[model samples]
Each structure stands twice: as C-alpha cells, then as structure tokens.
Target: MPDGNRQIVLTSRPTGWVAPENFELREGTVPEPGSGDVLVRNIFMSLDPYMRGRMNEAKSYASSFEIGEVLQARVIGEVAASKNDGYAAGDIVFGMLGWEDYSLAKGAASLRHVDAELAPLPYYLGALGMPGMTAWIGLREIGQPKAGETLFVSAASGAVGQIAGQIGRIRGCRVVGSAGSDAKAAYVADELGFDAAFNYKTAESYLAALQERCPDGLDVYFDNVGGAMLDAALEVANPFARFVECGMISQYNLVEREGVQNLVYLTRKRIRMQGFIVSDHSDLLPEFMAEMAGWLESGEVKYRVDVADGLENAPATFIAMLKGENFGKQVVRIGPDS
Candidate 1:
C-alpha cells in the first residue's frame, strides 16, 4: 500500500469543449476499507467519450459528476486490501472507481474479479470490456445486419467501431467504415478487414464518401461519430435498414448540436434508428465476454490501444481522444502491473 493517494477531481463544468483546466489532481490519504469493502490500486483508467456527458450539470441518462469530486471511470485495478469474503488481496478486478491511485469498492457489487491470464488487464478496459459489449449489444438488438447486407461504421478505427465492423464481417455483412484520417481508414480496411473505408475529414462530402464506399446502399449503420455523418447515412440507407446509435463524439463538444434534417428518410424508408448505452445491458456481459475473447484468441478480431503513461497525463489524453488524436482505445497506465 502507498503512504498517500493521488486523485483527479472535476474542477468545473465545460460549456462546450472540455479542457485540462476542468480537471485538477490532488494528494489524499489512502482510503481505508471496512467490512465488505475492498481497496483497489487503479492501474489502467479508461477514458471514454461517454464520460464527457457526465461532466455536465444538466441531467441526462447518467448522473453528472459533481464539482470538486473525484471523477469516476471503469478502471482495472489490483486489490491491495480487502475485507470482503468475495475478494482477497492480490486479485485483479474491474469496477467503477475513482481516477485515483486507490479506490474503495463495496464488495462484489462494486467490483468483479478478472483473470489476467485470460487476456491482458488492459483488454478488460477495451475488447473484453465495455467497448466490446457496446459493439455487441448495439448490433444484436438494433443493427441486426444480415449476411450480404452492407453495414457502415463511422469512427471506424475507434474503440467500439473497430469491434462493431469486425462483428459485421463475422455475420457475413459487407462492411464499410469512415475514419478521421487516411491512415486510420487504411488501418480499418487493410488491417481490420473492412470491405471499404474513407477518411471522413478529407471527404468531398459525407454523403458522397458514403455513397462511393457503400455503392449498394447501407442496410445497417453503426453510428459513433454522429451529426453530419448521420444525416448522410439517412440519404444512402436502403429501405428497412437498421441504425444503431452509439456515442456521438463529433457533437459532444458542440455548443449547439447539429440537427438531422433528413429524418424523413426514417419514416419513408421504414428505417429503425435507436440509441443504446452499454451499461444498460449488463445482463449481456457474460455472453459478450465469452464471444469476444474467443474471437480475439482465434484472430477473427483484432484490437489496438493508445496508452498514455502516468496519472497526471489522463486529462491531456482524454482531451486528445475527443479531438480524434488517439489511434485506438485510449487508456491511461497509472501504475505498474505488478
């Protein structure tokens, strides 16, 4: 156990774009665990697009992060001290813990043991974790892409989109993707095996790019970077297409969100557009973990991570991720694995 604990707190709410000033790091006493409680030494902290919404004061699907309070994230940690019958010291676990060196969890409800031998600990924060499940549940319940259908994914090289497009391939769908850069687009097409991909930032137009990539028209749209891309997807969507609404990273920092003017396509084409949060489908975790892990082990699925070392760099890493600077699943390596 460390003599002291270090933590990051939300200093203020952002009007639009989040900045490093919004977060502040502080030193504190290491938390003491009572009965049925566990003290975790956070090793890998996840920086996700969804966390941006929680920074606001306004109410939404998730609770807001109170000012001056330690920011919470899905963290992979080592159990340093435990008073719970379900857990013991030296166990590796996952939980919604603070962005700090040490986090206190309340028994199994707040933590779940993970096998480090099964996959790297960081995989729990990416492929075998929330991002992977987000891809699975969204496709299973909404996209429902059929074999031979054309499926498109925006932010194709991102944490969730990369997984989603590969899952589409497994289902025998012709997958297309759009990324922020030519390199990312190529990575998705060449490395990740997408049928086709384009750099959305360099595209002549979202609709034009989508049309060229999805010549047959889209049957399923796994939306991550929404806004203009969403409107374009509507224009190219085939009748009875399914649109799975994931995070909208492009619009998350906008003062006024862009409106979808092509919504008429939803009714005219009989398209089903639905939004989902990965946490809402906790019951599907076991199923998602088993399937994704097998795919990863078999080389059917591949993943990438953009790691920033040190806890102090978490704020900068998070800001970079939102700006589309990170290559893949962004994680902050806070401590040594041992």
Candidate 2:
C-alpha cells in the first residue's frame, strides 16, 4: 500500500466552462477509518455531468463542492481496512467516495457492497451504478414509453443516454438517437441497437433530423442535451408525448443558458415535460437492479466506458466530458483493483 494518498481538489469554481486550473492535485496521508467507518482504496471514479452542478457555488439536489476540498464521486474500491461491521478488508464496494487514491467512508450509509463476480468493477460506475439507474428511472417513471411508440434520445452515445435508448428498444419502442459525431451516431444505432441515429452537429437542424427519422413523431423524448435539441423535440413531439428531462449538458457550461422558444408546443400538444433527479427514487433501486442485472448478465444491454488512467487526469477528463469529447461513460482509473 502507498504511504500517501493522491487527491484532486477543486481549487476554484468556474464561471462558464470548467478549466483544468480550477483543480489542484495534492498528496496527503491515507485516511484512517474511524469507528463504524471503512477505508477503501479507490480503483475507479466516475465522471458525470451532475458533478458540474456540484462544482458551482449554488446548491442543487446535492450540495456544492467546497473550494480546496477534495472532489467527491461514485467510486468502486476495495476495502483496505474496516471498523464497520458490515464491511471487511478485501471487500469490494461502491460509494460516494472522494477523487483520491483512498477514501474513508465515515459511515456505511453511502457505501454498498459490490459483487465483483456479477460484473467488472468499472461497470458498477456506469451500467450498474448511478448512470444506469438514472436511465432506468427516467424512462420507466417519467417517459412511460409504450410499444410501437417512437422514442428519441439526445447525447445517445453517452452513459445515461445509451442505456435510456436501449431501454426504449427493450420496451418495443422505435428508438432514435442524436449524437455529436457521425461515428457516435453509428455506434448508437449499430452497436446499441437504436432504431436510427443522426449527428446533431452535421444535421441542418434538429427539427429536420427528428422529422426525417421520427416520421410518425416522438412519443417519448429522453433529453440529455437541453437547448436547441429541446426546442426541436418540442416542435416534433406527438400529442400527449412524454419528455423526460434528465440533464442539459449543452446548457451546463454556458454563461447564459439558451432558451427554448417552442415551449408553446407543450400546451398545444399536451406533452408531459418533467425533470428528475435519480437520488429521489432510491425505492426503485431494487427493482431496477434486478432488471438491469439480468440484462447485463444476459447481454441484452451493451455499455461502453471511456477510461482515463491516473487521478491527476480527472480534471481534464471531466472537462472533456462536459464538452462531449468523451465517447462513452467517462471514468478515471486511479488505482488497480488488485
């Protein structure tokens, strides 16, 4: 075991786009577990869009990250030491741990045991973790998709979007996706089984693209990139359509958010547009896990991971992810599982 822990801390908050200078990498002594706590050596750390909201000074569903404090993320790690009865040394676990070589779980509350045999360690951060849960809850609870309906997903090649689109397919819906690149669009349609996909960047207009692909109109719109896409979805939505607002990666870094001019369609079309936070539906986790685990085990669902090696690169990786530069679920491999 290393004598010191390497950590990434938020040195400053961002005004618009997050910069690498906003973060600082430092080394400190490995944290010791207190009573009822467990010490974990982080193997993988998840990079997500939600973390961007946390970096700001304003409060959201979760508290903002404090300046000079170590960043926090969903990490898959092995227990190095344990004072908690529920966890033992060598136990693989997943939790809201820090962006560091090691993390001290103050209590077992945020941590859950991970069966490494069920899936790879990194899958817990993507497919089997928060991203997957976000996809499941948004589609099942809010989207309320039905068979033969057309479903559209923005940022379709991404973590939550990929899973959300696949779930639409499993529900017997015709799933169309919009990605940033042609290759990403192809991956969404070809590899992930999306009915059709287009590159939003190359498309003349989102409205035109949606109209061409979803000729019958969209019954469910799983939105990850808000702004222009949301506007287009509004225009193309079928009457009584369900719009699940997951996140707005497009608007997250903008100094002034882009406004949707077509919201009038919501009233005219009787569309149900709702936003959700995954944490709010913890009760559905067991049901979600059962179904998701089965899909993962049976190979019904396919997931991709974009990994950045080393803790120091987390800030760069996170910045790239915010810009849609990452190809799939972005994660930082900070330490070896072994």
Candidate 3:
C-alpha cells in the first residue's frame, strides 16, 4: 500500500542568485516500498551553504541539481511504515530525505536511526550533525591549530564556523571570527568565547583590523569566505601558518571571483593551505559525535539555531540564508511526525 505525500520541487534553476519563486510546492502520491524499504514522515529539514553549488550546472565536488527534481536536504523523520529488517515503523532516523512531508526510501543507506535522547531531532541536521562533523575534522586534521596560536575564522556565527571557533578555543588557541553584523560578532566573541570577532561588512581594512586584534599574527585561518579575506589572511600569516579552505561564500554569487593580490606572501610565510569536505572523511563520524556529545553534556559547547516554522517557508528561508540573513544554522520545521 502507498500513502500520498507532499513535496517541494525545484521549479527552476537560479542563473545568478536564487529567488523564492524558483521553488514550487506540489502535492503528490507517496511512493510504495519494495521488500527492503521504509515510508517516513519528515519532522525537520536543513538548509546549507553547499546547496548553492547544487543549483548550478557547473562541475564541482558534488553533482548539480536537475531541474524539476525535489530540492535535496538532510531530514529527520519517523518511520511510519517499514519492511526493512534493520528498521521498524517507530524508528526515528536522520538522512537525505529531500524537502517533503513524507517519502518512501528503498535501501537508502544514508538514512540512519537517530537517538533522540542525545539531543532534539532537529539537531541531527545542525550542530550535532554534518556541520559539527565538518568543523571537528577541518580544525583537527586540516587547520591543526596550536595552543596560544591565533586562529581566524570567517562566517564565525554559522553552523560550521561556530563549532570551528569553539573547537579552536578548546584547544587553547586564541580564536577570532568575522561575521556580517555587530550582534553576530558580539555573539561569537562574548558567548562562543572567541578571543576577538569583527563585523567584516563594516571593516574598512581587513588586514589592519586583524592586525589590531591578533597582534601575534594568524597561525590558523579557517576560511569560509574566500576572495579578499584569504588575501588579507595571507599577508598576516605567521611562519608555517595553516589555512583550512572549507567554503567560499563570498565568491559563490560572482561570475568571476576576486584574485588574491598577496599570493607572494604565502611563499614568504611558508603557509600550508588545503580544502576538505566532510563526506570524504566519513570515517571520522563515530569519534567526532562522541566527542561533540561529551562537549555538549559537559557545557563546553553551545549551539544556536535560526528556525522557520513550516516546509512552505523553506524556500524563502534557504534564500535568506544564502544572502547572510540567517543568524545561525537555518532549519525548517515540517509537520510533526506521527
């Protein structure tokens, strides 16, 4: 037996910037399950920066989205019906379930049972999930921040950046962050324990601002926005500095990204720069979650969420996030799972 489902599909692709009109909400019949399948009712949905890359047909680390397909997102849902031996009807799981109220998943290994006892179901899509995992590995494996060293992060109040700064602080680094607004900057510095944070939008000279705050120079630069910020950090690098290229939100909208005028500084400073994605390092998830869970339980870590009330608002909320309108991790609450 198949149950009817409602879903939001990508009606059109964004040529430059995404608009809410680019998405369409449609009601459809729920798919039937095969022998090894489950029907799920989604409770929470995630909005992420990487989804912007998916909107384009350009080649990248991930595949581009096909027009008219359901917009993809990580979701937390309850299994309403199940035929898979590994799962049961009442199991609450988190996975890539797309933007929908319900879905039929057949042998979807990405879907895993979630422990609601660990945190709220929404957390699987935010702090305690992929974003958190990305921060842990980027800081530990790539950035390699050292105690008493200056660690700089852009988009510091976002899902990944927030955790990255916290992790750096835990490692005894002097962490500084750049955010879009004063409030966000204050939150990163005051609440997240970043040694210093600035509103990048208002700063006239990034290098000068960083120099004023991080007089010791940056040993680790966890980059979220590329372009001038990278160039600025390059000029302020300490000997053998490390740069973690996690994202380039600043260049995503531009047809031609700005160049780093200070490339010579990298050679002069002996800096090591690298890029990484969490999907490629899935092996680290088990250990990462255990550590993150312990941090949360011990009050060493804190997370913030910017949530929208319903699935219908998901498109606008996602668009707002891309424009830096969201204060923290952007999530959508779909109807309650039964």
Candidate 4:
C-alpha cells in the first residue's frame, strides 16, 4: 500500500459541457478510521449520468458536489482497517465512497458488505448494484411492460438501459433499443437479445428508425436520453403507453435545455409519463435482488462494463460517458480487488 492517498477533486463546476479543467488529481495522506468508521481500499468506483446533476450548484434530489472536495460515487472496496465493531479488515463492501485510493465508510449505514464469492467485486457497482436496481424500479413501478407489447429503451447499451431492455424481454415484450453507434446497437440486438435496435446517430430520422424497428408502436418507453429522441418516442408511442423517465443525459450538460414539443401526446394518447429516483425505493432492494439474481443466474441477463485503469482517469471517463462514448457501464479501477 502507498503511504499517500490519491483522489480526484472537483475544481470548478461546468457551465455547459464538462471539461478536463473541471477536476484535479491530488494526493493526500491515507486516512485512519474513526470510532465508527472503516477504512476502505477502493477497488472499483462507478461513473454514472446522475453524477452530472450533482456537479451543479443547484439543489436537486441528491446533494451537490462541493468544489475542492473529493467527488463521491458507489464504490466496491475491501476494508483495510476498521474502528467499527461490526466490520473487520478485509471485508469486501459496497459504499457511497470517494474517488480516491482509500475512503472512510463512516458508519454501517454508509455501506454494506457484499458477497464477492457470489459475483465479481465490480458487479456490485454495476449489475447487482445501483444501476441494476434503477432499471428494475423504473420498469416495475412505471413502465410495467406487458406480454406482446412493444418496449423501446433509449441508450440501450448503457448500465441501466441494458438491464431495462432485458427485463422487458423476460416479461415477454418485444424489445427495441436505440444506441449511438452501429456496434453498440448490434451489441444490444445480437448479444443482449433485443428484438431489434438502431443507431440513432446514423438514422435518417428518429421516427423513421423507430417505425422500422418498432412497427407495432411503443407500448412502453424506457427513456434515458431525452431530446429529439423523446419527441420521436412521443410521436411513435401507442395510446395508453407508459413512459418511464429515468435520466435525460442528452440534455444534462446543455446550457439551454431543449423543450419537448410533443408533450401534447401525453394528453392526446393518454400516455402515463413519470420520472423517478431509485433511492426513493430503497426498501425494494431485497425484492429486486431476488428477481435480478434469478435472471443473472439463469443467463437471462448480460452486463458489460468499460473500466478506465486508474483513479486519475475518472474525470475523463466520466466526461466520455456523458458524451455516449462508453461501451457500457463506466467504472474506474483504483486498486487491486483481492
């Protein structure tokens, strides 16, 4: 272990698009745990779209990331030292920890032990963790896709979107997805078993693409990218369709957010559209775990991850993810897992 700890800190808040100058890589002394804390050697840290919202000064569902402070994310780590009675050294756990070589999980509530024997440590940050749960919650609580229905998932190759599209398939729905590139679209359609998928960036028109992929119209729309694609989804949505608004990455970094010109479709088609935060449904974790575990164990679900090698690369990886450049769930590996 190194005598010093390396961390990524937010230097300045981004006004529009996030730039590399917005962050700094700094080294500090490795910290010791306090009375109720455990010191963790962070192995993998998640990079998510929601973190973009947290960078802003404006108040939102989650607290804003203060400039000059180490940015935080869902991390998979092993306890290196412990001052808490319930924890011991070498325990693999998952926590909302910092983007550093080591972090302090201040209390039991701040993290929970994960079964590394059951799955890979990184899986706790992706498939079996927050992203997986987010996909489940949005589908179960909002979209509620039915058998024979046409389900459309935007950003289908992403962390949550991939799971959402797979779950829709398990529910007997005909799943179609939209991705940024032909390779990503093919990954969803050929590898992930989506009924069909299209590269939205290359398509002549979003509506035309959807028409070719989803001929029956969308009975459920799992929206991760909102903008013109959303307007196109509204145009192609069937009456009484359910729209699950998970995240809007397309508009997240924009100075002037785009307006939905086709919101009138919500009333005209009696479409039920709702946005949700997965944290609000924390009580459903056990239920979601059971359901997802079955799917994962049975080979009914597949997950992909794009891992950047070091903690110093986190900021660049995050910016790339925001630009739809990541192949799947974006993660940063800071330390050896074992």
Error of 3 at 283 (Å): 0.9
lDDT of each: 0.93, 0.93, 0.88, 0.92
Q: Which pairs of residues clash in candidate 2, taking residues 3 or more apart in a chain or in different chains?
A: none
Sort by lDDT, top down from the best:
2, 1, 4, 3
Residue by residue across 176-238, what tens digits does model 4's lDDT show? 999999999999999999999999999999999999888889999999998999999999999
lDDT of 1 by residue, 95-192 (tens): 99989999999765669999999888888999899998999999999999899999999998989999999999999999999999999999999999
Please provide, for model 3 over 213-317, each residue's C-alpha lDDT reduced to its tens digit, 9 standing for 90 to 100: 889999999999999989999988998999999999988877777877987877788899999998998988899989998998888998988889888899988
Root mean square deviation (Cα) for candidate 1: 0.9
The number of clashing residue pairs in model 3 is: 1
Q: TM-scores, in order shown?
A: 0.98, 0.98, 0.97, 0.98
Q: Is 1 or 3 the stronger prediction by TM-score?
A: 1
Better of 3 and 4 by lDDT: 4
lDDT (Cα, 0-100) at 273 in candidate 3 = 90
Q: Which digits, one per residue and each the tens of the lDDT, describe model 2 over residues 1-338?
A: 67999989999999999999999999888977789999999999999999999999886889999999999999999999999999999999999999999999998769999889998888898888899999999998899999999999999999999999999999999999999999999999999999999999999988899999999999999999989899999999999999999998899999998888999998999999999999999998889888999999999999999999999899999999998899999999998888
Clashing pairs in 4: none
Model 1 residue 266 lDDT?
Answer: 95
How close is each model in CA RMSD to the real structure? Answer: 0.9, 0.9, 1.5, 0.9
